[model samples]
Target: MTEPTSANADREVLQMIPKPATAPEIGPWLWAMEETRRGLLRTVRGLEQDALDWRGASGEDNSIGSLLYHIALVELSWLYEDMLLVEPPADIVALLPHPSRAPQGGLQHVESETLAQHLERLEKARADFMRHLTPMTEADWHTFREPPDTDYAVTPAWAVFHLVEHEAGHLFQIREILRRWRAQERAAP
Candidate 1:
């Protein structure tokens, strides 16, 4: 656990605000992450399969589904493996299912689950993440968490931001897909 360096001094001003004893002062960081999760849920809820599944018609990287799964999987993995690295929390692994084991051909062969099921699991995982992060001591912010068997460089803090970005980008793509889909739907003979 690392202490706040001079680099973060400007950002730590709000850390002075009182937080509930239970939640601690993980404040702006946690709030930002929660809002991001909420935004993702809004995009994902009640989405049609075509809207969710459509790869870019013109051929582009990152289908919406792929992005959503990637975001959710990485966070889930962080909460499970990364958090346990130094002290090794056995109880935590028993808390939730490990993320779909990072797929077969690395990032390409990710798992397939219904949109509803994925959202449900992700929502649960989000709650679990809050439980882990909300009480995180200031020291927890300094250290980096790198998962074993993976080359990714993500701290728990960065993991939250990464999830937000992935979800938001896919949400944008999803909307674009929906726009074109609606046009096609109405244009049909």
Candidate 2:
């Protein structure tokens, strides 16, 4: 057989192994979260305030800022309310004071905020999440949680996975918003 190409070797070498930034025991989960965060930041780098507040022609009402706020809220909620089963700390509460979902599941008002402010909120919320997530042992990562009066159950691992997935979904939405905003600008006089 011919030797494998470098691209094939690179693909084989690629793995989800954890990095040193996280606690050794819970490294994989934290690494996933960090990777997701990096993807989000990469997608939105240099995004302008007006572009961030743009809603598409469909009147969907989901702007980049609102999605950023929602992403941060979901991660914090999953960690505190779902995994740890405790109240969110004061700093997190201050960063996102409103309920996670709006009255009609539409976007809440995020126009007053700047892109930098929203990014700062996301970073702060993520720092708090890491602080709480780092202490868990391997067994704790697998611990299941079932909130009162609900059949829904999840583990810390699933919660971290959900955070990553949540940000990814919204990252797509942000990119779409940016694309539409550019199209609108091009179409205008």
RMSD of each: 9.3, 4.0
lDDT (tens digit, per residue) of candidate 2 on 1-189 = 355467654565435768553447678767887887888899888888877877777766688888888888888888888998988768778998767677887657577688788889999988888887777777778889986666899988887877778788888877788887888999999
Q: Candidate 1's residue-wise lDDT over 87-154, tens digit each?
A: 32454344334344345443332234568766765666667677777777666754687777887656
lDDT of 2 at 71: 88
Instruction: List the candidates' TM-scores in order.
Output: 0.62, 0.85
RMSD of 1: 9.3
Report clash pairs, candidate 1: none
Query: Can you give the lDDT of residue 5 in candidate 1?
Result: 66
- Against the hidden true structure, what lDDT does model 1 obtain? 0.60
Q: After superposition, how far is residue 87 of candidate 2 from its true place, in Å?
A: 0.8
